[model samples]
Target chain A: MNRTFGEKVFNVFNLLFFLVFSIILLIPILYILQQSVDVGAVKSGLSLWPSDPSTAYYKMVLGDQGIYGPLLNSIYITVVGTTLSVLINAAAAYPMSRRDYKPNKFLVYYIVIIPMLFSGGQIPTFLVLKELGLLNTLAVCFLPVLASGWNIVLIRNYYRSIPESLIEAAKIDGAGEFYIFGRIILPLSKPVIAAISLFTGVGLWNTFTPALMYNSDPTKYTFAVKLREMIVVQEDMSRQFEAMMQQMALSSASGQAMTNEGLSAAMMIISIIPIIIVYPFLQKHFASGLMVGSVKG
Target chain B: MERKLIGKKKGGRLGTTNIVLTLMVLPAVILLTIFHYLPLPGVAIAFAKYNIGGFQEWVGFENFQYIFKLNNFWRAFLNNWMYVALNYVFIFPSSIILAILFNEVRIRPYKKFVQTISTLPHFLSWAVVGGIWMLLLSPSNGYINQIIEALGGEPIYFFANNTTFPLLYTVIAIWKSVGYNSIIYLAALSGIGLELYEAAAIDGAGRWKQTLHITLPGLKPTILVMFVLSFASILNLFEPLYVLSNAMVRESSMVLDTYIFQSGIMQGRYDISTAMGLFKSTISLVLVLASNFLSKRLTEDGQSIL
Candidate 1:
């Protein structure tokens, strides 16, 4: 473990490099956090430091039913979608994982190759949903996410970690395949299940594209779609911001200001905070899941 | 390999395992068929003229012909290649450098902290990341512009500028993905034998010499795999640009994916959009095959970068 002078300098440089880079990465989110709480009529806007801190923006954002609707929708989609995704993919993967399953190669090739290949473009996918009458319904949110080929691959690989004799022993007994799958395979595959659930949960929580393409209704929007909509209306908000800017120019004292940029930041915070809250716990599984999934490939 | 029967249950008619397996795979079969396989037939819609309920007429390649002539399509076409080129020049190497630096950290806890912190953006949806960056890059009051103003320089509106657009695009692309992507290189690094490094150290090789000669060469296959795969994704530059683009920046930012979105959804030119989608998908497959071929050569053991 002894280091030469050059190695010592390199270590110092490496630490500084990460330190500086990590700060560069962090400042935007940190600024957004600080900006969300600053009172709208600060007279001076967009400082690194908040001039005046208050809960006014939070109250205003919280009061709007626009924010709450999508908040609930995103949660509903994520919870339901993640649950169904794990179930469908895991169930499908269970058969593929068993070498004794007659169609394992056929099923794996069909499902796994789809992930490796290009997807049928967004338009056709959209049309399929529209034709199905699933568009603008909450079911649309979960449909595309229902059985991911990637999660199936991950779970199938995880199932390989279980002893082959375990399943054979169940077969030696009177246990049915479903009985063994439910009783043995699933319970043993908790780590991989948790991993896929975390990955799927993050994906569903942040899903914006399907919501954007399929659902025209605001009520059907997820947190991601809602977040974009709030930012997209900056043009409309800009007019109000111009008025506020002029009012600040005129008044020597504090003036009433509408939530413009602050509103979007608050929404951004809302969209991200739930993920942030859950992220630390899931971090280890996320890394291991990715590694396990890719190591064979 | 999968031909073996589990037990002495030899009945071909409705065996318990076969039935259970069929029941298990039914949902995946149904879902994939409906969503994914349908696109194969639905892609035919690209050739068909539009109507309310179904096809109006068979227009052959007219939809493809139309998009080729569109001004917006050309702009996005060039932008896609430009993004691909920039990713090669900028992102591909920096990620490896990051992985190397990360590997160099002697402090375990500190290394883990940096790794975890850097990958934080990967976990969040682009909508949230895009919003944060949009504010940070705002010409009026964004922190970047604030820095420019502090230095007595003019505040540049990054997204709206063609000159700065690519630069910001590259930085944000790297910022969002480098940490997560570097893990691939780190995995490659970890896969190298410790004895090689130990022998090098014993033979009076310094850390730099050891890393340059052993570690980087160990990562060569991975780096090339990433390179070839990314090269194929040049036209695939939709996600990042889709979030950041505005009408003003569409000239610089209109990728094929967004063009498809604009045509099909916004303009109701579903035929043209489907044509574009088919076009993109075909090229993507070609690129994937080419990369797979190249990666098989590099890895020397039939590796697929999927």
Candidate 2:
């Protein structure tokens, strides 16, 4: 374990490389953070430090009750979607995990995997959704992921990891399958469940597509959908802001200068905050879960 | 495999366990059937003159012929392939290199910190990342542009530059995914036997030699598996283009998804859109089967779930 001079030099260079790489990765985020807090700061362009930092943007964006409604919608979809997907996946996975469940061999290989490989494209799915009367509902946001074939396969793989003897022991005691699953399997399967839930939750929270495709009602917009509009339709947002200001009988020109750039930057940071908050909890399960899924299924 | 009668032993031949399990599975099965399986038939709409309530006549191969006749279909197809090609050229190798560099870091805290920070962005939606990047590169206000101006260069729109856009787009994609994507490599790294390194070191093999001899060889199967799997996802390049794309770089950035959205989805030309969708889906299916075959061939324990 003695290091040569060259090895020592390489070590220094390695550390320096990581340091620079880390900072480069962080620069955009730190810049966004700076832009969010500083009033009219984004208009001036990027700076290492803000000349005048304030929570004006946050206050301005949060002031509209309309904003909180979308946040609520995002939460509703994320929570409902994650919970239902996990349940559906677990329910489907349990039978398949039981090696003797003969029907599932078909389900796992063909029904689940094949559809995942290729499907009727979005037009068909869109038509189907409309046919089912799911268009313009929050159900549109969550339905697609709720029983996704990928999740079913993933959960089935996780379920297979459970010891058969535990179920066998319960069966010998004359416990029904429901009791065994409810009491034993579900409890033992928390880690995988948590992992998939995190995946689903984050995905649902961040999705704007379902809203864009299925819903035209402004009230149905998720925070992500709203953020996308806010990000791209900069001029429209300012015009809306002006209209809102007039509607509120406030002085439009002199009250505060809310550039679309500043507003969108604030919206972006605000939208991402939830994911960042839950990420610590996500880190533990997701890493191991990812490796497990890749390694097996 | 062992049981003579699955439910016969305790719950009867067509036992309560079978019945109950079937019941438990029913809701999910029906959901998947409705959502995934139902629309599968609607893929037929690609061949038909699909009017919602209007007379629907099957046009046979007319739609396919139309797609073939269109230049945009080919353009979008080529554009998607370009992303895939660029991805393999730069993103794939760099991820491996990143994983190797990360594996070499002897310092635990700094290593963990960097990995955490790098992986953090992967959790952000493409829209959010696009927004952040848009802010970071705005001509008047972008951090990068500010630096560009500091160097006495005129402000240049990074997203608009078709020539440099692919390279920059790949970099952003890598930034979002590189750390998260390195998990398999990291896992593969940990799976390497320590004795191999010891054996190499005692044979006068330094860090570089050991990596070349032991580390890379150990990572071969995983790298191949990852390569094969990612190939199937080449057509699923909707999010980034949807989020980061603009008219400024439409020539460079437009791909199958965006093209479909513009010409098919927006225009309500469901027939052509469905045709395009079927075309893309067919390729995806082929790629999936191809990757599965490759995975099974490449690795000892490989099982192609898809």
- RMSD (Cα, Å) for all candidates, in order, is 3.0, 4.3
Alpha-carbon lDDT of model 1? 0.79
Which residue window of length 10 is worst by lDDT in model 1 chain A?
A: A288-297
Judged by TM-score, which candidate is best? Answer: 1
Count: clashes, candidate 1 = 0
lDDT of 2 at B236: 76
TM-score, chain A, candidate 1: 0.89
Candidate 2, what DockQ? 0.51
- Cα-based lDDT for every prediction: 0.79, 0.79
Q: For residues B1-306, could you state the per-residue lDDT of candidate 1 as single tens digits?
A: 323543325345456767888899889888888888876678888899973456799999988898899888888777777877787788877878898888888798888888888877777778888888888887767778878887899988777786777888888888887887788888788889999999999999999899999998899887877766564456666667888877777778878888888778877778888888888888778877887787777776777776
TM-score of predicted structure 2 = 0.91
